[model samples]
Target: MILTGYLHQQLAAAGVTRAFGVPGYFVMPVWHAFRKDPQIILARHEGGAAFMADGYARATGNLGVVLTTSGPGVTNTATGVASAYQDSVPMLVISGQGSPTTFGRGVFQESFLLDRSASPAALLAPITKTALEIVAPENAAFMIDTAITLALSGRRGPVHLSIPLDQQQLDIPVPPSRSASPPTVGDVPAAPCVLAAAELLRSARRPLILAGWGSMLARAQPEIARLSTQLGAVVVTSTKAVSCLPRDHPMLLGHFGPGQRSDIAQAVSSYQPDVVLVVGASLSRYYANPLAAVLENAATIRIDISAEQVGFRMRADIGIVGDAREAVSALTSAIAAGGTDTAAEPDCSAAELVSAFQKRAERAALRQKPESHGMPSVAGTISRLSRMLPPDAVVIPDAGNHWLDTISLCRAGRTGGVQLNCGVGAMGWAIGASVGMAMAAGQEGAAGRGPLTVCVTGDGSMLMHGAELTVAAEHELNLLVVVFNNRSHGRVRLGQRLDFDREPMGTDIPSIDFAQWMSAMGLRTFRIDHADQVDEVLAAALATRGTVGVEVLCHPDEVPACLRGWIED
Candidate 1:
């Protein structure tokens, strides 16, 4: 069997039903082999292909696959690959390279340099968990299997494989058998560390549980909630884990980080916990560096699959290297067995904490009411949209002030409902990502029926990859794209205004009629300038078939309140 056929069979065996890419000469052979297998979703750009794959993985919790060709094709995918790397999304990037025999011949789109070993593999090495060049056809199966395993391993991330054109077309006498599944890491933590953590939580007067994306990846939401309830602790999530705990969970204190809402910030500042249990989070600066300062005096028990991530950005009093779900379950059981210290002083009862949180949330809502004049506020629109959407709707928010506003307003009712490109902070991701997510969710019994897949992006972001909307329309995907059309890069302008005290330059954008463009692309389009029109237009868009694009004219100066505070500070 040929190597190309073997590769496709292996991908199918691993449960990959779809692949995204832009076809090129180097990869034509493999493309032909996959013509009948794993439906290929043609993308307008290699970057869009990679972003689509990234979105598919996020939505389905499966390894996303992207195929591209040599030179510019592979280079174009760098941004998307980097974004996936930063977010720890599992993906396999297969780039077809010039033949190994023509390494120094300077063939068409040759990626290899004359003096060094620098090639597409080398270029992608830094951003991927593993990067390999398949020089030998015999090694294709091993390389493919290894790349797949590494992508899904601890601290999941993308892997790259550069296959020579000749190697891809090579036909060996016998095809290699499918490799065994990757070895699983044990979920149990060290006995001594678990005991110490249990004791600290059992005796602490004020305890907090901080969950991150790792918890969501581990499917540890139930364990986290159980632990929070048993220990009478408040739950605060990282931005990436916003939906790990339901928005209305009694013990939920809301998200913690730079983009936290004013009310959540107040609550986090006023209610200082004596101990914080950090689970499955990197404690990165995206949440703000001050998180470490806030918990400086508190006992911190950090549990993560990666030992390096245990004390990545903050000090950990007790570090446990294990799977989030298993470690959390063990800790809860240990705490139960150790018996709670009933005599320990309670700083605030669970009921009192919940009441305080609800009051703060109410105050925040009142403060965020849209004014009677000017374009609609991004936060206010998101708040209303959150209420209108179904409980299990999946929202993919792009990076920018728009996303920051979403973090403060939108609430995810179910786990893994909100997918944001926070790690790479890449614009234009949500546009293509929403298509992949909608495709995944539309599958029978995949995410249940009638679950809306929505992409919330800014004008700049929409223009970057809005071409993918055609893909959604062509596939008849159930997707909605809400574009905040502020006619400028609001975040960049905000930075310039605050940092340099200068009027924005190169930030303003010409007003593009996105509705018209989307309509031409066969998608239902709506253009609205007032908040009053939002509900009706959104309902109409949702009611329409396939994909819908809503272009909302927003105030350029309407920055997220959280971002405003950061700039002021």
Candidate 2:
């Protein structure tokens, strides 16, 4: 067997039988290998394909693998890879590079093909834990192992490995030892920090659990919920962490962010919690203004799997570097051993605090009506969709103004009910991700409970590789893709209109009947012209067994006042 074939075999051995990519000249040989392998699944666009891998990794907890050609192919996949990187989702990205023969010589597709000369592998260095270029076929197996190891190791992230065209096509010997192995979890260090964290939780009168994307990636939901329950703490999630807990639970406070339903910033500042336990969150600037104010006067205990994350931005009072779930388990064990009796007598005021939060949420939900600018309002759409779908339905939103609306309105009672693009905020995430998620839902009996998978994307987002609906149709995936047809980039248009004090230019998109287009692609379709008709259209779409697209054409001028305020602030 040749080196290229052996590499494909290694990918298969690692449980990544499917490989998605956009072919290019440099990757021709590798593409041929995948075509002959009978395992790899080719995709249309690099970005959409990589996101599909992300969804697969999330659902199965296996290292997702994707391949692409150098230059444009690799560049196009930046957003999705960054999303996986930021969220700590394990993924392996193999890209074909210009031949080593073209090193330093001006050649086609030779943009820094070797030494950080604008290569996608170099671009990914800052975001990824490991980035390597295999100039020789012999090093391919070792590099593959290292990349896989790092991707599945502490604080999982995407790892980039580039193989030069010459090396990939070479008829080099395939070493039997080159076979890829299943990634193994390493040792867990003793967590004395857990004892310190437990003491802080015991001493604090008011405590809050702030969970993030890592919570979902690390499967730390149960551990986090247990900790919150034992300490009588309020549980809140970031925008991307919506499904980290059961929203209907008494202790759950819903999402906290610019678009979240609850006034978490106000609550955090005014409520003055004595302790804030943030687990698995990277503390992105979008999540809070400074985070220091939110944690001020509060004993902050940060638990993350990576040491690099400990002092990255928000300084932790007590930093514990290890698996979030394991650290949480240790903390809970310590707390239980020194248990304080809170169960015998309920804290009267704590119950009131929970009620107050719920009341505020209900009031906010009611007041979040459509504000007419001209087109359909994003917030109103989200609220409407929230009402139409079953309480446990999964809402996967692509990044954009529409995402803001969905985050604010769509309510998921528990983890796995709702998923969002939290980390890198990629635009085309929902459609592909919804496909993967819907397949997972059906296999897991999500439909038996009610409506399963739903995707809401803005017109711009929908136009970007929306053709992936073919994948859905081909697979007969149970999914609904709800398009907010504004005929423009709604968020950018609003920014230009409000901030630039001018009508949007270059942002407007040619209007298209997406439902009709999708229907032609062999899927059920619905187009809603009026806001009033949204409920019925959305309801019908949810009930469909196969792929369906409901296009809601709204005036592009319509913008949420809250969003406008956010821009101003």
For model 2, give the 10-residue run with minimal summed lDDT. Answer: 441-450
Span of 10 residues, lowest total lDDT, candidate 1: 441-450
Global fold similarity of model 1 (TM-score): 0.92
Please provide, for model 2 over 1-569, each residue's C-alpha lDDT reduced to its tens digit, 9 standing for 90 to 100: 56578677766676665566778888888788886532455566888878877876776677777788888888878888888887778888888888777877867767684554676666878877788987766666676667777888877889998888888866655456555464677436356778888877877777878887777877888888888778888777777787787666778776666575435556556556778898878787787553567676788988777788877787888988878788888888988887785323333465467668776665666665554555455677677777767666778888777777676666675576677767677778887777666544443232223346778887787778787777777767767788888888877887888799997798879978888888988779998876677667777777777777888888777755346442122
Runs in model 1 lying further than 4 Å from the true structure? 115-118, 172-188, 263-266, 339-348, 370-373, 443-449, 563-569
Candidate 2 TM-score over all chains jointly: 0.87
- For residues 1-569, write the lDDT of model 1, one tens digit per residue: 78888778777776777889999999888888777547688988889999999988887777899999887889899999999999889899998988878887877887787744359978999999989888876677777778877888788899998888889888744433454444444457888899889888888877889999888878899999999888778888988898898776788877877477555655665677889999999887777455665688788999999988887777799999998998999999888898654525556665486667766664664456453237777877777777778888888888778788777767788877787787778889998888788776753232224578889998898788888888888887878888888899989998888879999899998998888888999788898878778778777777776677888888888768675542222
lDDT score for candidate 2 against the true structure: 0.73
> Which lDDT value does model 2 have at 44?
68
